[model samples]
Target: MTMQLLLTLLLAVARVKASTLLASHYSGQLYTLSLSSTNQLSISGSISSGNRMPAWLDLDSASRTLYIPDEVQWGQPLLKSFTVGTDGAVVPKEQIQTSGGDLHSTLYGGPNGKGYIALAQYDASAISTYPLPLTGAGQPLQKLTFTMPQPGPVPSRQNKPHPHSVFTDPSGQNLLSADLGADLIRVFRVGTNGTLAECSPAKSGAGDGPRHGAFWTRGNSTLLFTVNELSNSITAWSVLYQPGGCISLLKRQTTSTFPPGKSAPPGSKAAEVRVKDNFVYATNRFDRSFGAQEDSIATFSIHAASGNVTFVETTSAHSFFPRTFSINAAGTLVAIGGQTSANVAIVERNVTTGRLGRLLASLKVGNPGAANQEDGLSAVVWNE
Candidate 1:
């Protein structure tokens, strides 16, 4: 073979080897999947978590550590840590009991400049923080509970404060928790001693149910875009850095997660929200009845000056009830996991246009379950 052809073949092989994905399931399993350069997807390995439900995963690439939150409804859930091998498999390191019903978490710098995990416990109506480098099961460093006088507009879904997700701001000085039950985004200041002090919270529209959010920074302005699960919409907020380490959010606009002239169907809810280079992507679940047997991933463009968001289009998620989806580090591919369908899908993404092109590959890893039962896939993350 000519030298040019040999170099091309080597590059192709590298592309295939780089496209590994780590997927978590509600069935107590973590899977290592691979996507070929030609878009073929295959399961390479898996390990039983032995936990009730490992719902969310936060990866620390610098340390090659994976933090998984076990979401349990009744008993105390566990926060497990593992060392990810170079081959994409994981080895369990430690497990610590956390507050119940931990749905989502994020790793961020603590007050003392150490790594910390902020956990959002949905059922416990609390936010807990744990020190990094887990050694074994131990007490949380801090746990803050929330309460309200009465439920929001949707009493059934907003009976108490349910913190769905926890994330850090662009400066990493403040931590924000999206409380779905109370329709509020709670803010906390990271102190020098690794403690969190409560700051003023940002209130969303009644019944908006802010679940997950992403931050966008341009020049000196920072904007927050959140997917509201109850209202099936997205809200953009102008972030204001306060005098100290605290921050505030000024609501800008709210738009439907669906495309123009469209609305969510009955029992449909928005799931995940991710902000890429110049676009925002969110998942809508239970809306597959409109067209295909699959859910939809909605894309929106961010206005350069005002940081406003406008809906772009919607694409098939290639799975049913897509609860979570992750974009590759290159932003060239997306892996979506369906909760009820028990399927994982890979789709090509146009980084320039910020539009998902087509379904590349999909695989069924487990059996389907009911909508309410968390029996299938829960989350997907690129191993890179």
Candidate 2:
């Protein structure tokens, strides 16, 4: 069994089937990057405080660890941690806070079996739970804190409790949030120690500011899409998985990450809404980039008996403002990111006919405030 131990176990299964797509460019700080197959690419940045802003990132592949939600300045507002070493990269380590402040990180699946790192705390409309720490580094365990519900906008838009995005509900036991100034779509109950109770009120979309969302779990009738940046549109809903399940609003289209006549700004938004396998990607943050965040990945395609979303391909034309994207694991590759496209737009996923080719790499992340102010990029995937 020794030919150099079979070529180091065949290059460790060819770098785990050759996967490593990473992106996170959240503005002032947090701009990480990667892409592999021995292309061996690397880019990193870090800086914290000021606004702890590391925006969002999640990757828990059974504790390989990499979860972030830091937006802390004078303390209290973090859930940061990283450690994917062994050449798979990613290293930072610990940060943990979350008495609830500028939070917004995602990935939950731990009623106790392990894998929890959710947080969408707009100063406490709340949704924080940190348990992705299996003695890999420790220091996280803030556990329960769910309170969010003040929706029903209009008083100049309900003023506050804007818990942006924190989804999950395919009978994962519910925990869907998307409250841009509380326009609505909140439903929690996945407790065991990592808590969050409230329930119901899962529908609202007119000026539909409902931040990010996605879930089409192959269908049996479990669709759910939400990305209403103040009403640009993309609603969908229809999740009724009982245990106390029930979620309506089955349709709401109207998309435009900017490219059809264009025109968006004045508070600028529609940040993200990814869903892989059946295909679904969104991110429309024009906020003034000449009629669209310079065209940043709107591509859609899903109707497996009504999950609605048809518009296959637009990729911000050539890129610049995605702030997030993910869909790999042989589904090919789609890793994008945003905030002026700090860079990482791989595309290239023809896997048969899911369509999307060329531009196989756009890696250029390095300016999280010039070295690593935690670097601002918001989520990119493929660590699994």
Which predicted model would earn the best lDDT?
Answer: 1
Candidate 2, lDDT over the whole model: 0.61
List model 2 lDDT by residue over 241-276, tens digit each: 554543443444556555567665555556677777
Off by over 4 Å in 2: 1-17, 21-67, 70-78, 89-92, 100-119, 126-150, 153-160, 165-207, 213-226, 229-253, 256-271, 274-280, 283-310, 313-332, 335-380
Q: Assess candidate 2 and give its TM-score to the true structure.
A: 0.31
- Tell me the TM-score of each prediction against the true structure: 0.94, 0.31
As a whole number from 0 to 100, the lDDT of residue 126 in candidate 1 is 96
Pairs in steric clash, model 1: none
Compared with the true structure, model 1 gives a TM-score of 0.94
Residue-level lDDT tens digits of model 1 in 189-224: 987655789999999999999999999888998999
**lDDT of all predictions:** 0.86, 0.61
